[model samples]
Target: MTQQTQEPTTAELSAGYAAGLDPREVAETILTRIAAREPVLNAFYLHDPAQVRTDAAASAARWAAGTQRSAYDGVPVTVKENIPRAGHPVPSGTAIANPPVAATNAPVTDRLLEAGMVILGSTTMPDWGMLSSGVSSLHGVSRNAWDPSLTTGGSSAGAGAAAAAGYGPLHVGTDIGGSIRLPGTWAGLATLKPSAGLVPLHAPYLGRVAGPLTRTIADSAALMSIISRPDARDYSTRPYPQMDWNKRLSSPRGLRVGLQLDAGSGAPVDPEVAAAVQLAAELFAAAGATVVPVAPFMSAAMLTGIDAFWRTRSWADYRALDEAAQASVLPYIARWCSAGKDSDGAATIENYQRFAQLQQVTRQATESLDLVLSPVAPMAAFGAEHPMPSNDPDEPMSHISFTLPYNMSGQPAATVNCGFTTDGRTIGLQVAGRTGADEDVLAACAWFEGVRGDAAPDWSLVP
Candidate 1:
């Protein structure tokens, strides 16, 4: 018999399903949990109880007939609002009235549906997916599952919250900067920002890609196995070969791992966060991996350059909206993007060159190392009401220093809970690998999960 667990991890749920568990029963438990916690977490932007039950009933019938769609056929999953499902509004967490409904499902969503996974609903994000905090104009404030007063982080706010609150085993989120990792870190969830173009996206950009937020690294691998399939919609996708993502993970024996204590820009790492990440590096060393100190390669100039480029991009988006719609935006987001209202073509080009510089410098810095370890963010958590850790429009990107570079350089990065602060804030240890080394990154994180047992957050504090 499969061991009963507190959190319904993907593998455990699969085993239970195979052992005669009904999908309808699992669906009822999830729905009940969501009802109990939704007032405090505000995790879901849309949830249809009737739809969930209907889907589960079909899955239950399939199981009874000795036929199931996949190992995760009956598992419940949540998709971020930005990743569209047919007949749903893609508000992008804005205050705009009557947001446009999506006409089609995104590549990732299609894959999950094809695998017979039940979609719980769309999760929330900050307006225009710009801020790294959870105060959204459209969906209101999404709070941390561990502590409701603390921020959930964003723009993947609700996805992180759902994962932490046990809304389901898998929650899909999109990461351009630290959207996935920041929230995952603050909320004590396992999340990944895959190598750029590794998973096909409908609207692929320079750093944008979709990945999963889950309670365990093994669950993350289970999700990746389905979402990483080929999709012709993404023109920038790399040639990714399918493999057993849930394959056994071994120790980091003989691998050269780099430890980066400073980001060279943004907010300085808090002492508690630093200590937790350092301990994780020590564990790698104890497991036979050669741990070497790597100097900070990202500079203030590089950070500001990317910041300027992003502001310009956001300003364009803001200005395109009609006057009433523009006024409805989150004031912090409005103020931040307003700084780039007068940006010139020359200035925009110069600012965009920063992406190239970041890519070049990051490549040079980690060239000799198989993997790098760092703190996911400067601090553990911030106020749920604040738009960012600094709570200032002009200095918005300061908290994303550690996780942003990996996005630009196209390296796979994962965040797992390593420790907690003195006040009980969750701290995350970041594991990043060389470009195209997604499997290695997952393996290292999975191995760490095994060594760092029982660090799971207390769900009683969620409300």
Candidate 2:
């Protein structure tokens, strides 16, 4: 039996854990975490134990060479199946690996490898990352660490569980809706949705790439530094800066937080969630930040359309990638390929135009607001059987009302634990920045990590 020894954290392990606290040793810890919890949590869709060991061995060698890429070197991190993982089956966790191990890694993976992060394996995801409930027909459901009975949110289920279980210090997951944010919040970890172009998706889900299942904001930023670059292969990179994120100052030199007063929708937040947001507001104010109200809440109508757009657009594309490619996927996936197929071309065109208009509106309103803050999901983790609550959030039609718009606008976003409910469920505070404001968003996230109630992961209660 692997005795859990308050296992050294990402930071501590970087300094000591694996063979001499080497990353490979840290990889062993991840393998251990998976072995102990996988039977119950079922977080991974497909993890290659052999690869993990081989990578760990290399990680040890890197450490021995006094050239571990970064302190993160050797840490076996999980990747959501949606994003490309060069050569690995990225059927988004439908039917094992999709793109044959011969494919090249996603830019993020290249960055992860460059940063010395050992690729543990792919994590579970809803078919195509289209669903928000986190349960996949392929891997089943990813349970919340706080309460195994509830959802750890979705699309990044494996990423969230791996982090919550201390599988590794970080993870990589993309989010068009709340895929990244919801998982991190539900799993009680920090997550960031880089401005659309910051970390180019390269292939599918190319428009939005958010960091998920990370233990701390620093690792997320560090990962960003490695991956965010001008990749000629990715056209989206043209709009983002090619500058190095390592050049970014982690310090929040007195932030200007724009508080979303109503959070619009009259969507009543759980008292605990509300308290967490309020507490976060107070902390930001205390930390030399001037908090003020900001705008850009989606009208009730726009809320419903957001999820509709993501599902229809994502599935329609998933449907195109050749039969042989698609066959490797799950049946439920083929089912969701057109849930929103009825979305008229006119509606899509109009909605597409709305995205541009939304951007301008955000510019006018947020030109002066440094970072905007709100409840990550407006709720706590839910039951595992149903990725969502049996009873919907106030807006029953829009499960992802809070997160999708940002993805639509291509802005950077992040969720950090602010407080816990009386029932002990974790709540997250999301902070987003205007376009091209990734560094600013990261700076703000680092602030939250330092001050807000580190509500993520009650390891003491980890099942």
Candidate 3:
């Protein structure tokens, strides 16, 4: 079989099984790819070949017996390091030694396993999922597949790199502040940040959900179908019974898509980036969707307030650690903690107040629209070693202006590769929908993907 045909997607793998491709062979091919490319990308945090082989063998038997588990049977997938898997260490990408192993699989992990998917390993993230760039103290850095000098945006860093590099067809990553979408955009992949509680998150918190990063939207929808189910452990999880996410993809005719170029932050967007987003809007228009340009709804105060709230949480977690452990953290993370250490209870309350204001503005701006589209990040991928594109001390949150608002308002958002820069960097278009409109957000993304054909960069050309 050709190399391209060897790495089948979730649906392709299932169909290939019936056509006489053994699950064990597919599993071995994935393992071999991981071994060859992982060193360059730093994608896997903990990959066990033996365990993956065992799981593949079991899936093979099940297929042979006509008792296949689910549509993802034998499909290889990687989970983020912060996500727990039974007996695997949940490091959260830190320098702490001997991190405790999880006693049980996280709800998402359990659901994927139940569907007969092969767990390739855990992917790396920034320390405690704090940074947009994937420069972690524990596992080093995850390089972008298109350009290694540029970052694979984090905290879902490794998953993005793995997806772009074709390590596998499906990768799970969590997003709080553009983690999944940022990486997805930088690496030229499709990713989703589902509506809050649509995908059950253990230890519920604001602005966080586990979602998939894949080369194709159908694979993402397939993974969503399995992981979006209600888990009793996550009290905030909403019931998602019998939802066929894959079938939701259709021509987006008559969909009112509002295009916002800036988030009112005055952050300069790259000219190429702006053009790519406009081109995406044009694509939607051609697909029979009305593309309307809308004013930026997010303000400076709103962005700063959201940054402060998350930084405060990071500060609290940092303070709970021993002094030496805190010192061992990445300097950027340390600075993040130190900056928010002075925040009082009133500051947190004020942050929430600002959140409410932003939520209201978002609702008002998107009220008459079916979906809102924008650039995923203000620019293409930047230096892998730096925290942000700029070196200015006060500009840490500038890049995330487009993505953070959705996290605050609990809206479902997704990012798809729209086009490429002159130098070959990928550009992403963000599609966000109403609070409970997760399916619509994904459908719009699927439609965009269909119009764009396949935009993924040639990973084999990357050094």
Candidate 4:
């Protein structure tokens, strides 16, 4: 019967497993879902049915003997392709032939395996993990589970699609400039872009963090509890602090919440998206939280400067590749990175300084507010084939204004489906808190999810 259930949550799976359900049955359910949906979603880069079956059989034996490794010992999970998983090729969304295989697992991968979770293999992403749409150089396009014509936002593209399609209970995604949250929004899933350094990463960078994407906030929290474990490999990680991430949710009463509808520099928020976000703010106000408007912390120069810096960084990597490999990159990414070749040293340094400026302004803007609410993306899902909403390489980052600030500020942010667009695409309400406030942000998201009722689309109906 577990195999017959639709879109089961972690809690549901855990209870089922505890009640003598075979881990293989749950794994069979997941694999069946993947088989039916993957042809349309293109959500995974590497999936081996044999490996899945082998792992599930082992976990089934453990559960039968009452020797499960942990509460989630048999739970199915998927990691984004960029996360190293020893022997797996981390192509990082590029089309390089024979891409380098990871010599060792990423810290998050190690933690997940050590806890006895069954990894479902790596999901797909955009070329070089640069774009916010699902179109990729190597993996083709990953479409939304809600509608194949619409994009599953990226570069956590496939993770979002997989989570929404009920691939499993847990999916690991990396976010820097809204990769995780944007995909979470478009795919109608719960996602957390943890504070920088909160989750140990194999190669940490400014504004980069590994987090979870799932259909429910509690599942995201549960997965976070596992992946956030400290690892010495990440020198940039903060002191490991243990917390019951899946602990009881807290009331938001007396909390000062800021509602930011205007992103300041990106394309204007769609009327429907704006309305959905405003309604979310009103719900918070009604919940005994003081809701106030927060002035936009982003500027045109800041966004453009950061974009330039990223381009330069991308170009640096691209230029190092052989001409054949460079030519294999997505044309849009190739064009975007080529623009970076025009920047001089002085300009590049000046552009990089915008990071500090962004961090300072963001902190100052929300210093008095306990949390900030905004639209995860300015609009709902766009065409699945485009690299961005604009489809313009020169204006690549216009959609990231809302989600990028938190990454620069090193703050915790999350997205939960608030409402739907006129066309029925999902709208995401972003909940962000200052640095070290990840728990608070996640808790608020959990509370909001409770109040939001059952707005998620039924996966069984997807074509």
Model 4 TM-score, all chains together: 0.97
TM-score per prediction, in order, is 0.97, 0.86, 0.95, 0.97
Candidate 1 lDDT by residue in tens digits, 77-183 = 99999998889899999989889999999999999988888999999999989988788888899988887899999999999999988888999999999999998
The model with the greatest lDDT is: 4
Any runs in candidate 4 off by more than 4 Å, and if so which?
A: 1-5, 454-460
Q: Report the lDDT of model 4 for residue 342.
A: 94
* lDDT, candidate 4, 88-122, per-residue tens: 89999988899999999999999998888899989
Q: Over 4 Å off in model 3, which ranges? A: 1-6, 240-242, 248-250, 391-394, 453-463
Model 4, residue 419: C-alpha shift (Å):
0.4
Instruction: Give Cα distance to truth, residue 461, candidate 3, Å.
Output: 4.7
- All candidates: CA RMSD (Å): 2.5, 3.8, 2.2, 1.9
lDDT of each: 0.89, 0.68, 0.84, 0.89
